[model samples]
Target: MAQAKGNALGALGKLTELRQRIFFVIGALVVFRLGSFIPVPGVNPEAMTRLIQGGGGLLNMFNMFSGGSLQRFSVFALGVVPYISASIVVQMMGSVVPSLQALRKEGEAGRRTMTMYTRFGTVGLSAFQAFGIAAALQSQTAAGGAPVVYTPGFGFILASVVGLTAGSMFLMWLGEQITERGIGNGISLLIFAGIVAGLPGAVSNTLGMASNGELSVLRLIMVVGLVLAVTAFVVFMERAQRRITVNYARRSGGQRAYMNQTSHLPLKINMSGVIPPIFASSLLMFPATAVSWFGAGHQSRWLQGLTQAIAPGQPLYEIVYAVLVIVFAFFYTAIVFNSQETADNLKRSGALIPGIRPGRATGEYIDGVMTRLTGVGAIYLVLVCLVPTFMQNYWHVPFYFGGTSLLIIVVVVMDFTAQVQAHLVSHQYESLLKKANLRRN
Candidate 1:
């Protein structure tokens, strides 16, 4: 009876901790969503809406990332894109810049320093983007010819730059807090929340179109089926791994010799996770966004051609996007999973692949395996990202159900669920340890 009571109490303690963390994450997301509604000062909401409705190319994508904040011209209109861009820039720099590379090898303190630099980069990027947005808004007019900005001036530009920058920084801080205290990766969860929050509206829009005879029921069914299929595919690919067998030689003490042990190193099929898609999107969107925002009114013929070529549904856009995804998949996979480091660690532990020598040979073996795996992974990412674009273009399906959004949603949920399970397992282990201690006493 006493043991039963102790176990129950321990379970209850774990439940309390898990509940607190889940609540913190939910609260942070709620705050982010609420902020999405608070419009930037001196902006005409109706004009902004009209612009979004008519600006069906990159603006739609921007609004999706912002959780409709861009359509509302909200303070959080920049969303976390600036921070994501900053992080990618910093990470890429780490590979080429000696100082950054040194910092990467410095452990926790070094990581903190890198993070500080990323935050500063986010601020600068957000401010620049915000000023461009303000200038763009000044040049934009609604269908009825009303200015998107009610009072466009230097004051409005300053206020917008400050508001948008502050909002993005606040989101960055919130993401960090979530990472420290919540269930999953804070930045990923934030982007996940933004994307997922728009689902209901997307559903409503599709259904409404169907009701109005604009969309056939068959098409709707097809769209739903495609989304479900893509989601399952993503889950499978994300969980798939290749296991490499390693053998550790026997270790001898003064008295006894231990037998050799065997283990396997598991390399995930998609070692880069959703990073390739995110990075590709950022790179593709930057130029498109800049052209659309800055050159909207005074676009030259070449500028117009460039924008048209890179628009979301265009062939060139799809091709470039696919190529970028593939390249980033290999690049990011290389950065995050260093074959040399893994081989060195295995060697230090007296472990070696059955048919390969330790050190350079092991590294080469791992690298060769990684190269092949990365190629497969890159193709998978490209297909997953581009398939939805084709569906949207040919079938007129909404972009909300696109492959990129679905990938982010599915991956983030998987990660969040895994984190929760990890916490539960850790809690149960602690309870067992405590009970063992009590019995010993």
Candidate 2:
């Protein structure tokens, strides 16, 4: 009873210390939401909605991912997607470009340089995307023949492009700030917040549909049950890992005795994490969203046909999306874990798998393990993301509450919670050490 009480007290104390960190994260999120409401100058925010809805299909998904910011033509309309996409591009380039590859191997300095390149790339990409968006806005007209943009000219284009690009940069800075000074990954947490911001609207829409007899109560209940079940399953799979036993030899100095230590290398079931879904969703958006700008004449006959066929919820779209998700799962897994590097490091450290010899054998063994694990991980990712995706397509359900968004939300939240707990544990350890010193005194 006393031990339990002590533990509870310790937890409470740790929580108290974490209150400041929690507040900082909350403050940043609040700022983000506020930015999402601040429309860019010279745009009719209401008309922007009409334009987006008029475009249809994939733009809606893009708007949803941006947390309704895109639809509003808000300051944060661009979100952090440009940065994320640029980062992905830069990473892919680093693998193929000799200079970038060499820079990548240079440790902290290399990483800092690469991060700078990513930021530069983000600006370039954001500017290009913003220009495209500005051009699209100029061509859009309301039902009443009102212009979506207050004025259509180079001035408006320049201003909107600068505003959106700057907005993206600001968002990137905010995310970095959160990561450095607050709890959780700033960029991912931002996306999570955006997705979650749509929840109230989604729920209200569902209720409205149910009231109008568009969706039966039984169907709604079934959907909610399915979402809950999927959420639970994702949580379980996210935590699941394959543990490999590791043995470290003892090395003693002059008079000190050190014991050999043993630990388990935890290989997570979903090693590629939330990256695959993000890649798949972003890649799927490029063509579909780009076509919306073209008002019939802008698109070639074949391109228009392609747009209709490949838009979200289409059979062809789902198949391509599923394949991309699987491909990225393996690709990203390989990038994150290099078997040769791991084996070499293990060999240098005098560690070997139970039966496998060090060096080439260990590399092959690790490669084999990664291949098998990645296959499972890829299939798991495809099922979790696609099943609910297809449900949305077949049943006319909202994809917001479906598996892809839910997977990202759950995984990001889990990681955030783990980070918070780690900080709390460290704080408790410091307190214990301080008390020990006091007792010694």
Each model's total of backbone clashes: 0, 0
Q: What is residue 381's positional error in candidate 2, in angstroms? A: 1.5
lDDT of 1 by residue, 389-421 (tens): 888888777656666788888888999999999
Q: Return the TM-score for candidate 1, rounded to 2 decimals.
A: 0.93
lDDT (tens digit, per residue) of candidate 2 on 45-111? 7788887877765567667777899989987888998898888889888877899989989999999
Candidate 1 positional error at 401, Å: 2.2
Stretches of candidate 1 off by over 4 Å are 250-258, 282-291, 294-299
RMSD of each: 2.1, 3.4
Cα lDDT of all candidates, in order?
0.88, 0.83
